[model samples]
Target: MTPNILMTRIDNRLVHGQVGVTWANTLAANLVIVANDDVATDDVQQQLMKMVLPDTIGIRFFTIERTSQIIDKAAPHQKIFIVVKTPQDVLRLLENGVQLEQVNIGNMHYKEGKKQVAPTVSVDDADIEVFKKIKEFNVDLFVQGIPGEKKQDIFNLI
Candidate 1:
């Protein structure tokens, strides 16, 4: 059965304050899936995230492929909140058949090759390309760091 996907957000710092506290509580998400290949294999990072989150919320660190495979199998009552590190990861999840209706571009920190798009977002040519491809799937993409804030169209910022 398809899982109830409450939110799919791209935040380089996965399971952070905004996601762990604000967004999770706002969405009433019971499960937070941190889908990133690097974090999936890192024991220390996984441990730290477990420490940060409350015991009531369930958290998982899985690769994009593994997430795609198991996401749809979530129990009907499980409201899932997916978090990823990059736009490419969102595209990959879609390609792998994890159905997503919308995506939130939370924070993509500025880096050498990326240009600043919004105050909390930065992207390069490849990142922009991936986002455009993701749009083809009819997924709504917007930027809103916190729950109550106004959502900015990610395309406009890019």
Candidate 2:
């Protein structure tokens, strides 16, 4: 009963304004899965994300392991959109056998040691390494803040 993973994105903000409203609408997603270990356990964060999501779209929070498990049990008609905090999480899912076809780099804002790779994406050395690893998996990786915007291949920036 695996769900069709319509799209997978890496945005540190997870289910924020643009993601909750715009991206979900654009993808016509019925389920929005926030796959992250930290946020899955934080009640406050979970409540806040739920508040912003449109009632039309269902939302779930799970750690990488649980998320992978759900992928197999997902209803066949469910159109799932996955959002994670970092490339590492995406890598974890990929390593766990999730059949992700493409990954969008929505946003990875600047951090103390991270370097800017795009206007909306910044990564540290470890992140760069993970991005490289992601590429090796042969999953298409690119950056796009919203639908219709240009997608920059992350490998070029690394």
Candidate 3:
């Protein structure tokens, strides 16, 4: 059976206190999937995430392509909360056949060329263009740091 996708979020900080505790509890997620190429192979990063995550919640680190495949075949009981480092990763998952109806923009920290869109979100020219492409897939994108925070439409911020 197909897994129930609780939430798909783009947070540069893949897994941390806010995500492992606050977001996980709010979403009632059974599994947290960090679909990031770099972290998938980084044993240290994976271990750090494991340290903060509650033992009740399951976690997986996977390359974007692998996440796209496994998500589709996940157990019926799995309620997944997916987090990726960038919009490009989410786009890649879409291209690889991972279905998503909406994506939450969270904590995209500012970099040199990136413009701060929301307090917690920043985007460069390339990111803006990639976001536009994602919109074409009919996926809704909004910015919200936590469960009850007001969601701002990503396009409006960009």
Q: TM-score for each prediction?
A: 0.97, 0.95, 0.97
lDDT of each: 0.92, 0.92, 0.92
Clash totals for all models, in order? 0, 0, 0
Model 2 RMSD in Å is: 1.1
* Candidate 1 off by > 4 Å: none
lDDT of 2 by residue, 1-158 (tens): 55699999999899998999999999999999999999999999999999988899999999999998878889888899999999999999999989888999999989799889888999898998898898888899999998989988987887
Tens-digit lDDT track of model 1 for 94-141 = 999889999999999998999998889999999999999999999999
Among all windows of 10 consecutive residues in model 1, the one with the lowest summed lDDT is 48-57
Cα displacement (Å) at residue 9, model 3:
0.8
Candidate 2 Cα errors over 4 Å, as ranges: none
TM-score winner between 1 and 2, please give it.
1
Worst-scoring 10-residue span by lDDT in model 3: 1-10
Task: Give one digit per residue, the lDDT tens place, for model 3 in 107-127.
Answer: 899989989999999899999
Worst 10 residues of 2 by lDDT: 1-10
Task: Estimate candidate 3's alpha-carbon lDDT, on a 0 to 1 scale.
Answer: 0.92
- Which regions of candidate 3 are displaced past 4 Å? none
